[model samples]
Every structure is written in structure tokens, then in C-alpha cells.
Target: MRAYERLLNYVKIHTASADDAECVPSTERQFDLARPLCDELKALGLTAEVDEHCYVRGWLPATPGREDAPCVAFIAHVDTVPDFPGEGVKPRVIENYDGGDLPLGESGRVLTVKAFPHLPKLARRTLIVSDGTTLLGADDKAGVAEVMTLLEELNEKKIPHGKVAVCFTPDEEVGRGTAFFDVLRLGADFGYTIDGGFEGEVVCENFNAAAATVSVEGFNVHPGEATGIMKNAALIAAEFAAALPADETPATTGGRKGFYHLTDLSGNVETATLRYILRDHDAGKLEEKKATFERLVASCNEKYGAGTVKVEIRDQYRNMKEKIDETPFVVDLALEATRECGVTPICDPIRGGTDGATLTRMGLPCPNLGTGGFGFHGPYEHITVEGMDAVVRILHAIVRRVSEMKK
Candidate 1:
């Protein structure tokens, strides 16, 4: 099957992962997508295994003499983000985009360049986009399809590739993709997560992440004649948000700049809860950001009484660059692969954390590559056919280059 056809097949399976869940796969539906992938890999003459938790592992053994070459792996998540609807995704292909607004959904919503400034660069390309109602599931599905197609090509041509390890992970959107991952069992020297955006992009640095939950208790009273008798929880929550640096959010900051992002806020007069996602590339600066959050929480509690507010902070992941720098050849292999594929490699810092970031910290030396996709985690998500093909070519080239590397 063609790469686009493979992506469309995967998109038909709803694998949206949730953050607030406690399950291993997070959602049972993820297996629906993963099972078929395991079968596909096995049918392609590769060794494949589908775990009970929806973790799919597959391997293409190196050609007889190529086994001594360095083992390189490729990974992509099976689950789409819960931020958008993954069910009933009506993906349509626009043959030769005109760089104009393309109407989506029955509600008359359109994918317009005026709204997404990056659309023009995709003009003249065959774009697979959603119908404005549901997400296209291109985030990592594109990556999955690209890898699968590359594997199929390598097998058919009987390419002399080093052992290629592949995995389809679950709950990446929920920040626990690598929680149950057994890296030692997979046994790859290094890997690449084909899970980011922008073709030709390589991400080796990502944010050190943390999550904070602030709970507030308020005295609910009758509004009339209440005077100073009532303390509003909602007001306190708003005050806490106001105290954060406005310019540090994802919208305002780019590159290595850190941010305190308030992801969710809810509750009323009697009780309120605010969730903040903290991020910074520098460990010290990341701690400083957390300290700032704690200090604000303390100040709020001191002003509102000891029992009025409660704050809980949890560390998520740390910077992977420190570990990645130890294996500089991994970066060179990717750059060399990009050049071989006739694309200029774009190496940049990741503003958001990824499974690769955590895996690298876990001693796998994994870096992130692009999915040839854009507008991820939303209904506007899309991937170009040309882009997917480019990624497949890049992957094939990267494997050959790594095989040629001096051990």
C-alpha cells in the first residue's frame, strides 16, 4: 500500500489518549489501532509483538553481514491527542493546494492561509487535511505510516540495513508513553522519534517539565449584605494566574525560553482548581520557575489563611540534550541522512516535551524527527503526501548512513 493509504488506514482507528486516566494504555481503544499494525509488520516478514498494554514492537533483522553494524531504531506513538476529536475523522485530499481557504466540515469551516500563515508553503502539494470538525490524526500517525512504508520498501528491495527496531507507543499525549517502555529489552544503540512537525527538522533539546495543581477553598455566602464576609475561590485562582509572567507562555516564548502555562482552570465561589504546566530547558531555571510557582502559592495561602489554599507540584521530565551531547554522532547521522535525501536539516530546540526526550534521559540517546505535518493536536492538523514520502526517504537514508558509521 502507498504511504498515504497506510496513514488513512491508521486514522480510521480512534486512539485518542487521555491524561486524567490511570490505565496502562490509558484508553483501551489504542489497541484497536496497534493490533493491526503488529499484523502488518509481521506480514512484511519482520518479527512483531503486540503487548497487552498496546505497545507494539517489531524488528527487521540486518542482512547477514550487517548485524555487526550499529542498531538504529524508529518510533512513533499510536495514540492521538485528546485535545481534539479523533473519532469519525473525515480526511480528504486536496490535489495541488491553491494556497487559499479550503472549506471543511458541514458547518462551513475552512482551512485558510489567512488563519494559518504556513499554508502558503504547502501550496502545490497534495495535502491531507481534516473536515474542520474532527482532527486528521496526522500528528504521529503520519510518522507511523512513513516508518511502515519505509520498512516495506527495505524488505522488498532486500536492502542491507542494520537491524531496525520499531515501536508504536501509547499514552504519549498523556506524558506516560515511556512509563512502561523497556528500552533494554528493545536493544537499540540509538533511535529517532518521527513525531514532530516540519519536514527536515531534528529536535535534540526539549523542555524540562513539571505540573502543578493549586486548590483553593472559599467561604460561600449570600451576595446580598455579605460585605467582607466572603472570600471567593475563583477570584483567588484568577489572582494566581495574574501573578505568572505573561510573556513566558507557549504563545509568547520560542526557542529555549521557559514558560509557566496554565492549562486548566475551573471551580466557583466555594472551591477552585488551577493546573499549570511548567517548562524550561535549563534545569536550574526550571527549578527557579517551580520556586516562583511555590512562592506564589505560599503567598496566596498566607494572605488567604493556611487552610484556604493547597498546592502540589510534580516533576515530569528533564532536558535530554545533556545526555544526547555525549553521543554527537547521532546528530551527525541525522544531518547526513537529510543531505542524502536532498533536504536541508533543521535542528531546533523543542518547546514542548516528547517521549524521545524522556527516553534519551533514560539512556537511549533518542532524538526527534519531523512528521511532515502541521497544526498538530487540533482539528486543523494535516500532513502532505509529499512530506510523508520525504520522511520515508529520510528514514531509509538515515538507516543506510548509520550502517556505514564507524563503530
Candidate 2:
């Protein structure tokens, strides 16, 4: 099947990962995509295994005469973001885009160049986009399809290479894909996560991330008879969120600028809860951001009475720069592969976290490669057919180069 066909087929599976689920895979339905990947790997004569949580693992043996080379890994996540509806997707391939807006779905939805200027860049190129009624699921499934296609290509061509490990993870949308990943068991000298956007973009660094949850307790009394006795927990929760800097949010900042994102808030007059995500590229600033939240909570508790406000902050992942420093060749190989594919390489810090970020902390030294997608986690999500194929070529080149590095 073609790359676009693979993407279209994969999008039909609903793998929306949940942030609140306690399970490793978050949602069991993600296995719908993982199980079939295992079968495909086996068909290509690779050793494949699928776990209960939908984490699919495969090992492609070295080609003849390259058994002693250094092993490398290509990683992708099978889960899609839960921010949009991932079910009942209807994808259309616009062949030779004419720099005009393409209407999606029967709902009269259109992806206009006026809204996204990047649409015109793909003009005259084939692109697969959603019907505008639901998400296209290209966030990382595009990465999965590309990686699998490359593996099949290598196998069919009898390309000489070292051991290559493949891992299709779950819950990446909720930032937990790497939580249950067996890094050591997979056994690679280094790896790359093809889970980012843009064709030439290579991300070896990302923000230090943390999740903070604040709870407020208040006593409720009849408002008519208890004007002073009634405390509104929802108001207190609003105050806690308002204490953060106004300019730091996903909508307000870009390119290394970190911000506090208030993801959820709900409460009544008696109780309320506020959820926030803190991020920063600088370690010092990241710590400061967390400290600011704690200080705000402490101050609120003092005014609202002791134990009235509580804050729980959890560190999610740290910047991968230090980890990449220890394994510089990983980034180098990514750059080399991009140039070999005839794409201009652009090295930048990821404003958000990737599974590679957590894997780096786990001692894997994983960097992120791009899948040439844009408008991730939203309704305008799309992927260009040529961009997807070029990335596949890049992956193939990276694998061959890393094996050639082996003495």
C-alpha cells in the first residue's frame, strides 16, 4: 500500500489516549492498531511481540555481512491526541493541490489558506487531510506508517544494516507512552522518535514539564442568612489560576518560551479543583514556575484558613539537552540523515514534550525526528504525501549510516 493509504488505514482506528486513565496504555482500544502492526512485522520476517497494554515491539535482524554493526532503534507512538474526536474519520487525498482551500466533510468545513498560510506550500503536492468533522489522527500515526514502510523497504531490498529495534508506544498523547517502555529489553545503542512536525526539523531538546493540581475546600452556608460564613471554592480556584503570569501559555508563547497552562477547573461553593501544566526550557525557570504555584497556594491557605488550599505538583519530564550532550552522535546522525534526504535541517527546541524526552531521562539518548505534519492536536491537522515519503527516505538513510559507523 502507499504511504497515504497506510495513513488512511491507520486513522480508521480510534486510539485516543486519555490523560486521566491509570492504565499504562490509557485506553485498551489502542491495541486495535498495535496488534495489526505486530502481524505486519511478522509477515516481513521480523521478531514481533505485542504486550497487554498495546506496546508493540519488533526486532529486524541484521542483513547478511552486517551482523557486528551497532544497533539502532526507530520509535513511534500508536496513540492519537484526545484533544479531538478520533473516530469516524473520512480522509481525502487532494492530488496536485492547486493552492486553493479544500472543503472537508459534508458539514461545509473548509481548510483555507487564509487561516493557515502553510497550506499553500503544499500546493501542487498531494496531501491527506481530515473531513473537518473529526481529527485526522496524523499527529504520530504518520510517524508509525513511515517507520513501518521503511522497515518493509529495508527488508525487501536486502539492505545491509545492523540490528534495528522498532517500538510502537501508547499514551503518548497523554505524556505517558514511555512510562512502561522496556528500554533495556529493546536493546539499542541509541534511538530516534519520529514524532515531531515539519520535514527537516530535528528536536534534541524540549521543555522541562510538570503537572500541578490545586484543590480548595470551603464551607457552604445559606447565602441569605450567612453572608460572611459562606466561602466560594470556585472563586478561590480562579484566584489560584490568576496568580500565574498571563503571557505564558500555549497560545501566547512559542520557540523556547514556556508558560503555565490551566487545563481543567471545576468546583462548587463547597469545593473546587484547578489543574495546570508548567513548562520551561530553562531548569531554573521551570523550578521557579513550580515554586510560584506553591507560594500562591500557601498564601491562599493562609487567608482561607489552614488546610483550605492544597497543591500537588508532579514533574513529568526534563529537557533532553543534557542527555543529548552525552550522546552527540544521535543528533548528528539525524542532521546527516536530513541532509542526505535533500531537506534543509532545522534544529530547534521543542516547546512541548515528546516520548523521546522521557526516554532520554531513562538513559536511552533518544532524539525526535519529524513526520512533516502540521496543526497537531487540532481540527486542521494534515500531512503531505511527499513530505511523508521523504521522511521515510530519511529514516532509511539514518539506519544505513548508523550501521556504517560501526567498525
Candidate 3:
């Protein structure tokens, strides 16, 4: 099957990971993609395994004389974001896209150039998308299919390559993809996540990320007895949310700007809770953002009563660029590979995290490459035939160059 066909097939498998599973892979259904991918890798003549953690790992041994070459990896996550509709993902391919407002299947929602603005760049390319009822699952499914295609082509053309490793991880959308990843077992010197971004965009730096939960405890009283004697927990929770600057939010922020995103909220007159995600490229600023939220909570406690508001903040991931800067060779090599495929690489800092953020901190030094998929985590997600094909060409070039470098 072609790469796009593989994408359409795998997306229909319902691999949306759970956010509250508390397990390694976060969801049992992720195995839907993991097991088959493992078997397919073996079918492609590579040594592959599906560990208990729901990670699919495969290894292609180096050519006879390139034993000294370093092992490189291509990583992709299997789970679609849980925030969107994922089941029965029906993909439609618009061949020779005319660069206009492409209508998604009868949803009255149009993929407009005015909204996305980047839509025109995909003119004449085969744009692939869902029927508007569900997400296309192209966020990382595109990455998965591309890697599989690369392996298939390498075996078909008898390309001489080094110890090339491929890993399809689960629960990356829920931030646990690499938690149980056996980096030493995969044995990659460095790697790339074909996860996000527009075409030609290479993401090296990402947000210093954290998740925070704020809880408010309020005294409840009967309507007749409630004047000032009652403190509504929901009102206190809203106050805590309002304490953070509205300007410093995901909707208001853009390139390199930090934001405090309120992901969820739930509460009643007696108790309420708020869940937020903090993001910033600068580590120092990221901490400041978290600290600012804490201060707001403290002020709310002072008003409501001590211990009335409680806050718990946890680190999710850090900027991968810190480690990548120490090992620039991998980034340079990938850039050269992109050039070889006749595309210029655009280095852009990701506003969010990837599996690379976790792996790089684990000493793997992984960066992110574009999968030609855009509008992630929602029904607006789409990819193009020509765009995915370009990335495959770039992968082929990288392997050939790495093999040649061994000599």
C-alpha cells in the first residue's frame, strides 16, 4: 500500500489515548496500532518487537561494511488526541487542490484560506482530510505511514543503510509516550519525531511545559442563610482563573510568546477545580508563568481563607533545544538531507511539546520534523500527497547520506 493508503487504514483503528489512565501507555486500545505495526515491521524483514508498554520498536541492521555508522531513529506516536472525535476516520483526497476554500463533508465548515492562510501553499497537491465528523488522525498517523513507506522502499531498492531504528510510541498526546521507551534497546545515537508543523518546518526548540490544577473549597449555606456567610466555590475558581492575565493566553499568544491555557474546569458551590497548561519557550519565563499562577491562587486563599484554594503544579517536559544545541550534527545532517530532496528546511520553535522533548532529556537528542500534517488535535486536520511524498524523499536522502558518510 502507498503511504497515504496506510494512513487511511491505520487511522480507522481508533487509537485515541486516554488522559487519566495513569498507566504507561495511558490506554489499552493503543495496542490496536502497536501490535499490527510490530508485525508489519517484521514482515518488512526487520527485527521488531511490541513491548508490554505498548511501544513498537524495530531495527534494520547496517549494510555489510557500514558497521561503524551510528544508529539513527525515526519516531512517531500512534495515539490520536483524545480531545477530538477519532472513530471511523474517513479520509478524502482532493487531487490537484485548487487552493480555494475546501469544504469538509457536509459540516458547513470550510477549510478557508482566510482562516488558515497557509492553505494556498498546498495548491495542486493532493490534500487529504476527514469528512468533518471526525479528525483525520493525521497528526502522527502521517508520520507512521511515512516511516513504514521508507522502510518498504529501502528494502525494495536494496539501499545500503546503517543501523536504522524506528519506534512508534503510544500516548504522546497524553505526555507519556516515552515514559517507558527503552532508548538503549533501540540503540539510536540520535533521532527525529515526524510529528508536527507545516511543510518544510523543522522544529528544534519547544515549550517548557507544565500542567497545573487549582482547587477551591468554599462554605455552603442555604439560600435563606447565605449572605456573605456562603462562599461559592465556583465563583472562587473563576476568580483564580481571572487572576492570570487574559492577554497571556493561547488565543492571544503567538510565536515565542508564552500562555496559560485553561484546559478543564469542574466544581460546585462547595468545591471547584481548574486544570491549566503553562507553556513558554524560555525555561525561566516558564517558571515565572507557573509562579504567577501560584501567586494568584495565594491571593485567592487570602481572600477566601487560608487553605481555601490549593494548587498543584507538575512539570510535563522541557525544551529539547538545550540538548540539541550540544549535538548540532544531527540537526545539520537532517537539514542537508532536506536540501538534497530539493526543499529548504525552516527552523521554527514549536509552541508545544513533542516526544523529542522527553527523549532528548533522556539523552537521545531527538528533534522534530514535519509530517506535512496541519491543524492538529481537531477536526480541521489535513495533509497532502505531494507534501508527504517530499518528506519520504528527504528520509531516503538522509539514509543514503548517512551510509555514504560511513565511508
Candidate 4:
């Protein structure tokens, strides 16, 4: 089957991961997609298995004379983001797009050319989009379908290629996709993550990410007698948020700029909580951002009481550029494959992190390849059938190139 057709089938499963769940996969629903993917890999004659943690791993041996070629791994994630409605996804296929404002279902949300200027460039292409109420799950599912289709093409066409490994990871949206990953077991010299946006985009750098949580403790008293005794935690939480640099936020920053994103906030008179994600391409700059959070918590504690406010911070992942730069050939191979597919490659730093970033740090030296997807993690998400076909062609090129390599 075609890659877009497989994407249509996979997005129907509710695979949104939980951010607060303490489990490895984060949610049980992730297995709903993982099991089917494992079965499909097995059907393709690859040795495949889904572990208890929901990681689907598959291996395909090289064809006859190509046994000496390097084993190349292709990776993608199964879980969608929890920030939006990922369940009940009803995809709408627009065969040969018109490059105009397209209405999505009856949800009154239009995918406008003004909001997404790239739409005009995609004229006459087959576009698949969501129904305006939920995310299209194209962020990484498009990658999954493209990889699956690549495997099918390799088998059917008798393509000459090296050993190939494919894995579908879970909970990537929640930043724990690689927590239980076994790099040595899959046994690849290097890998590429099919989790990037748009066609011909290759990501060698990503953000140095960290998550922070601020807790506020307040004393509650009756309103009539609360003037001197009551301390409002909710109000203090708001004050802390207001003190943050308005310009340094997700809405205000782009490109190589760093930002502090307030993801969740809830509070009452007695207790309050604020969750934030800090991101920067430079490790030193990311450290500065974390220190800013610490300073704010200290200032709040001084005014509200010594123990009224507290902050906890944890590092998520670092920029993969440092690690990827160590082995430059991995990125060059992807760029060469894209050009061979008749597409100009766009090498940019990802504003967000991917499983590739973590896997690269784990001595895998993996970079990211595009899935022909755009406007990820929200209702505006979309992909093109032609674009997916291009990615599959690129994957085929990569496999052939690997087969030709010496050792």
C-alpha cells in the first residue's frame, strides 16, 4: 500500500501520550498502535518484536552479496502529542489541492494561505489534513508510513540494499521515548529519525531542553478576617508568571532564539503549580534560562515567606549538533539522497527536540529526516501524498547508497 494510505489507517488509533504519567510508555493506548506496527514488520519478513515497554523493533538482513554492508537504522515514533485532541482523528484527503483557503470538515476552521504561506507552493499536490477539531497526527505518523512503505518497496522491487533496522518508539511527545531504548540490540552503525517537518528538511541540531515546575504554598483564612493572616497562592503564582520576560516566550521567539514556555498552570488559595519548558540551542544559554527560573523562585520566597515558593528543574536533552558533527557523513548521506530524489535539501536547526537527539547522545549519531509534514502538534497539521512518496524515494536512495559504501 501507499504511504498516505497507511497513515490514514494508523492515525485512527488513539495514541496520544500522557505528560504526567510515570510509566515508560506513559499511556497504555500507545500499545494500540505499536502492536499493529510490529505485526506489519513481521509480515514483511523482518524479525520484529514489541517489548513490554511498547518499543517496536524490527531487523532486515542484507541481500546475499550485501551482507558486508553497514547496517543502517530508520526510526520514527508512534505516539502523538498530548497537548491537543489526538483521539477520534477523522482525516480529510484533498486530491490535487487548489492553493486556496481550505475548509476542514464542518469545524469552521480553514487552513488559510495567509496562516501557512507554503500552501501555495503545494498546489496540485494531494494533501491530507485533519477535520479541524483534532490534530492530524502527521508529525511522526507520516514518517512511520513512509518508512513502512520504503520497506515494502525494497521487498517488492528487489532493491539492492544493506542491512536495515526499523524501530517505532513510544512516548516521544512526552520526552521519554528513549528512556528504555536498547541501542546495541538493534545493532546499527548510525541512524536517521524520520520525524522532521516538510519535505527535504534535514535537522542536525535541536534545542537543549529542560522542564521546570514551580510550587507555591499559601495560607488560607476567612475573607472577613483574612487581611493580615491570609496569603493567596493563586495570586502569587500569577505574579511569578507576570515577572517573566514577555519577549522570551514561545509566541514571541523563533529561529535560533531561546524561550521559556509556560505549558500548564493551576492554583488555589492554599496551593499553586506552574509547569514550564525551557529551550535554547546553546547549552550555556539554556543554563542561563534555568538560572532565571531559580532567581524568580528565590524572589518569590523572600516576599511570601522563606518556604512559600519552590522550584524544581530537570534537563531533558541537549543539542545533537555536537554529537552529529563528530560523524559528518551521516548528514551528508541524507542530503545526497534528497538531491538524488530531485529535491533541494533544507538543513536547519529544529526549534524542538526529537528522539534522534537522545539517541545521538546515546552513541548512535542519528540525525533527522523530514516526513513531508507541516504545522505539527495542533489542528493545522497536514501532509502531502506526493511529498510522502518523495521521502520514500529518498529512503530507497539512502539504502542503495549504504549498500555501495565500503565497510
Candidate 5:
């Protein structure tokens, strides 16, 4: 079966993860996709199972003469981002795209070439998009489909390759994808996360990330009695936001630039909370970003009261490049595989984090591979059928190259 076919079937199942959920999988609905994926892997003659945490793991032994080659693992996440509506995704398939502005079904949302300059390059290719109501789940689902198709091709064609391991993870959209991951058990020497955008992307570096929650406490008073004593928390929170560098934000920054993104803010006159995610490719710069938050909180407290403002900062993940550099072969092999498949290699640093970032730190040394997906995390999400096919071919090439490598 083709990779896009699998993506169409997988997107119909709602697997949007919740950010507020405290469970390992974050949502029980993730199991909806995990169970079937495990079953599919089992049917493919591989040992596969879905764990309690909704991680679907599978392994296929090396071909007869390739036993000495290093084991290679592939990973993809199952859950879509909770920030957008992820349920009821109705995908629209456009055969031979004309590279013009296309309107989504009835919702009045248009995918315009002017907005997305890459549309011209995708001309004449089959494109898949969602009805403007929800996300298409192609961010990682396309990756999942490509990996599945790779396995099927390797097995049916009797392709010579090393041991192939795969894991379909849950809650990746919520930053907890690897919280319960047991790296020692899956046991692949090195891996690739099939969770990236575009056809030829090979990502090794990503942002060092951290999340901050700034809480404000104020004295609420009647509007008529509002004087110097009344410190409105909402106003203070707004001030805090204004203090941030306007140019250093998700909207303004691009390509290796660090940013402070305010993801959520809620409060009243008495109390207000601001949640921000800080990201930078450099660990030192990330620490500086965190320190900026601390300084802001201190400045606010000094003006109001000693304990008027408080901040809680938590480190999410670090750049994987430090770990990936130790074993440069992982990236080198991916680039070689991409070139071997006639796809020009795009080795750009990821603007965001991936499951591979945490996995690489956990000793897996996994880099990221693209699944031909674009415009992720919203209704505008799209992918090309030809792009997914290219990824599957690249995966096969990577396996073949590994099989030919000396232990």
C-alpha cells in the first residue's frame, strides 16, 4: 500500500493530544491509532506491540548476511497538536496541483501561492489538505505512513538490510513524547525520526527549549476606590509581555534565531498568569532567556511587593546537535541516502524541537528525516503524494546503505 493511503486512513482517527492532561499518553484517544499500527506491524511479520504508554514498538531481524550491521530505528509521533482543532479531519486530495490558490472545502480558507512560496515547486504533484475545520494530521502521520511502507517494501521485496526497529510514539505534540520512553529496551544503535517537513530535509540541530509560567498576585479593590493601593494583576501581566523584545518572537524570528513566545495568558484583577515557551539553538542563550524571565519577575515584584510576582521555569529539551555530532555518521548516512534517492539534501537546523532531540540526549543519537509534510499544526497542513514516496525510497536506501556498512 502507498504511504498517502495510510495517512488518509490514519487521519480519520482523532488523536489530538491534550496539553493539560497529566497522563503519560496525555489522552486515551492516542491508543486508537497505536493499537491499529501495532496490529499492522504484526501482520507485516515483525514482532510488534503497543505498551501501556501508547508507544507502538516493533522490530524486524536483519537479513541473512546483514546481521553484523548496526541496527537502525525509525520513529514517528501519533498525536496531533492540541492547540488547533484536530478532530473530524476531512482530507481533500488534489491530483496534479496547478500551483494556484486553492480553497479548502466550504470553510472559506484558501491555500494561496503568495502565502506559501513553495507551492510552485509542488506543481504537478498530488497534494493532500484538510477541510478548513481541522488539522490534517500529516505532521507526523505522513512520517508514520512512510516508515510503514518502507517496512512493507523491505519485507516483500526481500531487501537486504540490518535489523530495523520502529516506534510510533504518543503525546509528542505536548512535549512529553519521550517521558516514559525506555531507550535501553528498543536497543537500536542509532535512529532517525521521520517527523519533519519538506521532501529533502535532514535536521540535526534544534532549539533548546524551556517553558515558563509567570504568576502575578495583586490587591483587588472597587473601581471607585481604585488608588495607589490597587495593583491590577492583568495590567501587570500586560506590562510584562510588553517588556519582551518585539523582534525576538515566533512571528518575527526565523532560521536559528532565538525567541520568547507567549503561548497563554489568563487572569483577573486579583490574579493573572502568563505562560511562555523560550527557545534557542544555543544552550547558553536559552539560559539567558530563562534569566530574562527571572529578571522580569524580580522587577515586577520590586515595583509591586516582595512576593507580588513569581516565575516557574522548566527545561523541556536541549539541542540534539551536541549529541548527534559525536556520531556524525547518523546524519552523513541520511544525506547520502537522500542523494542516492535523487532528492537534493536540505540540512537545515529545525526551528522547533522533535522527539529526536530528547531521544538523542537519551543516548539514541537520532536525527530527523522529512516526511514531505508542510504547513503543520493547523488546517493549512499539506503534503504531496510524490513527497511521501520519496521519503519511503530514502528510508529503503538508508537501510540498504547500513546493511552494506562494516560492523
Candidate 6:
């Protein structure tokens, strides 16, 4: 079966991750995908296991002469982001796409060349999209299918590849994918995550990220007798929101730029809570962004009462480039593979975190590769048949090249 067909099949399973869940996988539904993946790997004559954490792992033994070559890995996430509807994704295929505005489902939604002009390059190829009611889940499902199909190709063609390790992680959308992952068990010298966007794009650097929670304690009193004694927590929450630099936000930031995003807000007069996520590729800049929040919280406390507000900032993940620098060939291998497939490689810093980032920090020397998806995490998400085919070639080239490389 084609990779796109595999993608459409996997997306039918509802694997949307829950936010702030205490468990490793976040939701048991993630196992819906994990279990099947392990079974498939086992059927392919590989040792596969599905642990309690919902991580699907499989090993493809090295070819006879390739035993001394370094072991490599391919990683992808199972859970879709809860930020959008991930259930019952009806993948609409636009075959032989013409270079013009293509109408999606009802509601007058159209995928136009103006907004996504890069689409012209995908003309005459099959485009997999949603029906305008839900996200297509191509964010990582495309990655999953591409990796799966590559393994099948390697086995059928009897390709001489080194020891190949594969992992399907859960809850990456909630930033806890690697929370229970066992890098020692994975046993790969290095790996590449196929969860990136666009063909030939490689991601080695990702944001130094943090999640913050700000709480406001209000002193409530009767309106008639509330003179100088009542403080509205909701108003303080609004004030806190207003105080941050309006220019520094996800909406305002782009390539290599950092931002503070307000994710959730709740509460009223008695107590109020505001949640914000911070991101920056540079460590110093990330610290500055965190300090900026601390400064803002201090100012709010000073402007209000002393004990009126409290803030907690927790580090999420750091840039993988620092770790990738230790062994640069892992990235160079991907670039070499892209060229081998006749695609120009575009190396860029990740705008968000990935499972690779966590694995890199855990000593796997992981980087990221593209899944040829764009406008992810929303109904606008899409991937092309040509794109999927290209990535498969890329992965195949990377593996075969790695097997031939001298450690």
C-alpha cells in the first residue's frame, strides 16, 4: 500500500492527547495506535514491544556485512494535538491537483495559491486534506506512515541497512512523549524524527521552552462595603495579560524568533489563573523571556497587594542543536540523503519542540526530518502524495548511506 493510504488509515483512530494529564501516555486512547503498530512490526519479522507507557518499539537487525555500522533510529509521535478535532478525520484526496484555488468541504473554505503559494510545486500530485470540519492529523501521522512504509521497503528490497531502531511515542502533543521513554532500551547510536514540515527541511535546533502558571488571589467583599478592601482577581488577570509586550507573541513571531503565548485563563473575583507557554531558540534569550515574566509578576504584585499574585515557571525542553553539535554527522547524513534523492536540503530551527529534542537531551543525538506537511494543528493541515514518496526515498537513502558509512 502507498504511504498516503497508510496515513489515512492511521488517522482514523482517535489519538488526540489530553493536556496536563498526570499519566505518561496522557490518554489510554493513544494505545489505539501504539498496539497496532507493534503488531505490524512483529509481523515484519522484527522484535517489537509495546510497554506500559504506550511506546511502540521495534528493531530491524543489521545486514550481515553492515553489522559494524552505527545503529540508527526513526521516531514519530502517535497522539494528535488536542488543540483541534482529531476524531473521524475524513481524508479527501485531490488527485492531479491543478495550480489554482481548490475548494474544501462546505462553508466556502478554499485552499488558495495566495495564502499557500508554495502549493504550485505540488501540482499534478495527490493532495490529502480534510473536509473543513476537523484537522487531518498529518502533523505526525504522515510521519508515522512514512516511517512504516520505509521499513517495509527496506525488508522487501533486502536493502543492506545497519541495525535499525524505530519508536512510536505518545503524548508528544502534550510535551510528555519522552517522559517514560527508555533511551538505553532503544539502543540507537543516533536517530531522526520524521515529524517536520516540507520536503528536504531538516530541524536540529528547537525552542528552549517553558510553561508558566500565574495565579491571582483576590480579597472579596460586599459591594456596598467594598471600599479599599476588595480586589477583583479577574481584573488582575486581565491586567497581567495586558502588561506583557503585545509584540512578543506566537502571532507576531516567526523564523528564529521567540514569543510568550497565553494558552489558558480562568477564575473570577476570588481567584484567577492564567497559563502561558514560553519559547526561544537561544538559551540566553529563553532566560530573558522567563525573567520578563518574573518581572511582570513582580510588577503586578507591587501594583496590587504583596500577596495578591504568584507565578510558577517550569522548564519544558531545550534546543537539540547543542547536543547535535557533539556529533554533527547525524545531521549531515540527513542532508546527504536529501541530495541523494535530488532534493535541496533546507536546514532550519524548529519553531516548536519534538520527541527528537527530548531524546537528544537523553543522549540519542537525534534530529528531525520533514513529513511534507503544512498548516498543521488545524483544519488547514495537508500533505501530498509526491511529498510522502519523497520522504520515503529520503529515509531509505539515509539508512542505506548510514550502513555504508565508516563509524
Q: Please, what is the TM-score per model?
A: 0.91, 0.91, 0.90, 0.89, 0.92, 0.91
Q: Per-residue lDDT for 167 in model 5?
A: 93
Error of 1 at 204 (Å): 1.2
Among residues 3 or more apart in sequence or in different chains, the pairs in candidate 2 whose N, CA or C atoms overlap within 3 Å are none
Residues 92-158, model 6: lDDT tens digits = 9998988677777883678888988888888898999998788899889999999999999888989
* Runs of candidate 5 exceeding 4 Å displacement: 83-88, 220-232
lDDT of each: 0.89, 0.88, 0.88, 0.93, 0.93, 0.90
lDDT of 2 by residue, 1-407 (tens): 55666898999989899989998888989999999999998998889999987889999998877888878888999988888898988888889988778887675878889887878888888888888888898888999999889888888887888899999999988878888899988898889998888888899989998999999998888888776777789989888888878898889999888999999999998999998899999989999998998899889988888898998999888999977898798899889889998999889887888888888889888999989988888768888999999898899889889778763
lDDT computed for candidate 2: 0.88
Better of 4 and 6 by TM-score: 6
Against the true structure, whose TM-score is highest?
5
Q: Tell me the deviation in Å of residue 110 in model 1.
A: 0.8
Candidate 3 TM-score versus the reference:
0.90
Stretches off by above 4 angstroms in model 4 are 83-88, 217-243, 265-272, 296-305
Report the C-alpha displacement of residue 341, candidate 1, in angstroms. 1.4
- Candidate 6 residue-wise lDDT at 209: 93
Point out the higher-scoring one by lDDT: 2 or 5: 5
lDDT of 4 by residue, 237-323 (tens): 999999999999989999999999999999999999999999999999999999999899989988878989899999988999988
In candidate 4, list every pair of residues with a backbone clash.
Answer: none
Model 1, runs deviating above 4 Å: 105-107, 217-238, 266-272, 298-309
What TM-score does candidate 1 get on C-alpha atoms? Answer: 0.91
Residue 48 of model 2, lDDT score: 97
- Screening candidate 6 with a backbone cut-off below 3 angstroms (N, C-alpha, C), the clashing residue pairs are none
